[model samples]
Target: MAQTTELTIGYFTVIFDEHTGWTGGLLVLNRGGRPVEFQCTLPVRPSRAHEILFGTTLRDHLIGEVIGPILIKKCRTPLSMVCCDQAESLSLSASGGVPVALVGEAAENDEGPITNDMLVGASRVKLAGATLHVPIEHTETVEGIAGRFVDLVDAVEPFERIREAIKEAQSQISRAS
Candidate 1:
């Protein structure tokens, strides 16, 4: 049997509302940051096929369009018909407020199932088949990196814009690949 390599992929970013004191962030948890990595901020909008394929109502469509591509790209699979918005919201929270990592892999029937932990901390990621979701607490770090991000949020506007641009560039690169 041929061995399949696990791919570490995720989408992460920082968002800020200078006037409202609101901020959000996401980090796609992969093994490490890399040239083959995926992360970005794209204008996520709904498509007609989204409803039919995913069994999503108009309301659901509205929310999914905003973050669907991120999840799909990270998972390296087609979007699910029924999405757990709570999980998606958690992902956005990670994107805007703290560092969040969403991770996944395509499963081969010849191999095993994929879980959420594959993207975040190995101890925290939970996966069912090819679908995966990570817990918020998984952002915990022994080195206090997340704390720095939280403290730096206010000072991270320029860096955040750059991060967003990088994510866009990464997405473009994936499409090109």
Candidate 2:
């Protein structure tokens, strides 16, 4: 399929540091992979009680329930679809919001049942030369949303930028204190 529509794509991720808690960054890109908007959350350090209560689900709750939603809300541009690199953030797609996917290497998307909206897992989708583990039924949506631009985006690159930005922010905060 060819990309006929002018589309905007969003790459969102949450990074964690044991010393500073968690920080999230969302980068929205146009069809040309240019930045349209970027937003980040301050470090969210939970109490020991929260850690005990959430346990294994702590990461998911923080990234998916807290940080991911706020980052999405802060975006000014209307994103045609969202891409993430981690499993914890996958819960963001369940909101019935714009299409959200966990983008990974093509080799990672093993052939299997595609997880539906009601389910808690993901379905692997091959897009461009990469693998997109999308929530619900976003495989085709991404194929069309990306179109020619899909070839232009090395989806993992934006995440590196976001991570660097967040780390710099943390350093800045430490220096200011």
Candidate 3:
């Protein structure tokens, strides 16, 4: 499998505003970082009752359990792995039916040097100088897929494109309204 080349990666993120609620976007990119497909959801905001009910778990529930899976399901392209910027979105790995990685800043407060095992529970991986944490069971799969693209593209750069696309989508939505 390592000898096989080329893989598609799905970058997913959700943007929220008081008025817009939650807007989710998924950008599917080829090994070269060119977009193959893009999907975004209509904004969904929790009601005041829902906000209170969910409490501290609201964001995770909305972004991970709800928005994340919806975007993944709506994507047409088969993704080798899905990468998300928010840790809450990591929950997608549990039911996304594909490997999911949470990309973010490094944890600097660890008691000692960070080893793959320490991070592996979260299926953490380093690619293009970014740290990504995946589901423990999918660690090997995410790593293998990421390995193919590390040399061909900066794994973290496509995320910028995803963000830009999300902003563009938000503006379009606003204009439409």
Candidate 4:
């Protein structure tokens, strides 16, 4: 099979409900923010024993280690970078072998630390609008990917789509049961 070099980005998020422990969805989009592929995992409700064993790290482990990789691996389209809203999901970078980042609003104080911020689009754009948290090693990769679509795609928009998709998926699952 021929390898595809299209610039694709993956957005991942997990929603947790009292009944459903964690339901994660990964939405793959082209540079223009068009949906390429989407994969959602079955709800994973960790047992009480597992929660006790994991302690405070339960969410990070469940979302990052367990759910995130499964969704990412199932994606048929090749992704250049994976963007997530949760810091816990940043761990997907290491496990999934793709540059992962946490997208959020930048800090108000410009004098603060810029060490971890991933600037999207033009350098002239206000830095306080959106920032991405990526591993130190993957900084360049994430920046390069973000730069390409900075003008075309809003960094925070795809996440909203993922959230809506998860809700839709959950409703379907609920209706079936």
Candidate 5:
């Protein structure tokens, strides 16, 4: 909801490019009313919480452009998911409790091991309403991982959370006014 009051939104997105490695990012939509934009680095991976966020500043190269795109391609297969959110601890059902690693789309069919470590990678990003919880996971094959990433795009929906948070933030801004 776009009101006079400003708001912010935290959204999770997965990107896939056959030519390059699959990458994901957390988006912060600043609706603060003032035109000032807010752009911050995502410190953690969404599916595999333990893994460090992609930290290279490649904003000037083709690979960098591939890393974050406005539109993402879709996939037809299922990818392993690790819920990463500082808001909640991850609890998987496998031994070692390591999150399930995701495979790429171009690889031969094989369901990777699911861990009790819970695919929950614990990284959080705050935006419009509430903090977006995300974890990161990667597979041996980039193709499989990219494919799984596509599945992620299809699954783990969070638009409603964003909308609610934006509304709440706007109300708070209005009150302040």
Candidate 6:
């Protein structure tokens, strides 16, 4: 029998406000860049203790340890991979949940070959002028990410949907006040 692969990808990002604190959202997309599932967290205001205790690791702590896990836990669908806007989210791979990676905008004409892929670290996958930093253990994910975006436009397109949804939610919250 011929094998078939179905890719259910996810994009996760967190936005922070000085007054409202941090909010996170996760959007899962099918092979065609259509939304499958989405999960968003309530605005989380870390106490002063959290700021002082977490110290230098505060951003990583809130993202990877606090908010990211909450959103990922709410997802019922199993994700093939999650592309994140923050590199701190790469630590989500340690949760032993779905594979997670950070997608960054590549510099202009940055078409050089990906290096350090063979090493046990982040493997860079260039797609549509964006660089996806896949975790070392999930090196096999490169094939799926590449194949999925071949027919689709860009891998980072799902992030737009997630951010827009969050903005709409924020507007609704303010209106209720």
Q: Which pairs of residues collide in model 4?
A: none
Better of 5 and 6 by TM-score: 6
| Cα RMSD for candidates in order | 14.8, 5.8, 5.4, 5.8, 17.5, 6.1
Candidate 6's error at 125, in angstroms?
2.2
Question: For residues 44-120, what per-residue lDDT tens digits would candidate 6 score against the true structure?
Answer: 99899989998888887888898999888888777788888776787888894678877765211123433343224
lDDT of 4 by residue, 41-112 (tens): 888999989989998888879888999989987788898988777767877877888988776552122245
Write down the TM-score of every candidate: 0.27, 0.82, 0.82, 0.82, 0.21, 0.83
Candidate 3: residue 153 lDDT (0-100): 51
Residue pairs whose backbone atoms clash in candidate 3? none
lDDT of 4: 0.73
Tens-digit lDDT track for model 1 on 14-44? 2322232212223333223322323334433
lDDT of 2 by residue, 1-177 (tens): 122335777788887788988889998877677777889999899999999999888877998899999998877777788887666666777773788877764111113432344235556665555777766466677667756575455766888889888888888989999
Candidate 5 TM-score versus the reference = 0.21
lDDT winner between 3 and 6, please give it.
3
| Candidate 3 accuracy as lDDT | 0.75
Position 41, candidate 1: lDDT: 45
By lDDT, who's the top model here?
Answer: 3
Query: Per-residue alpha-carbon lDDT of model 5 for 30-116, expressed as tens digits?
Result: 322121222222222223322234323221121223322221112111212322221111222132222322211111111343332
Q: Give all candidates' CA lDDT scores.
A: 0.34, 0.74, 0.75, 0.73, 0.28, 0.74
Tens digit of lDDT per residue, candidate 3, span 25-98?
88887776777888888888788999999988888799888899889888777789888766667678779788
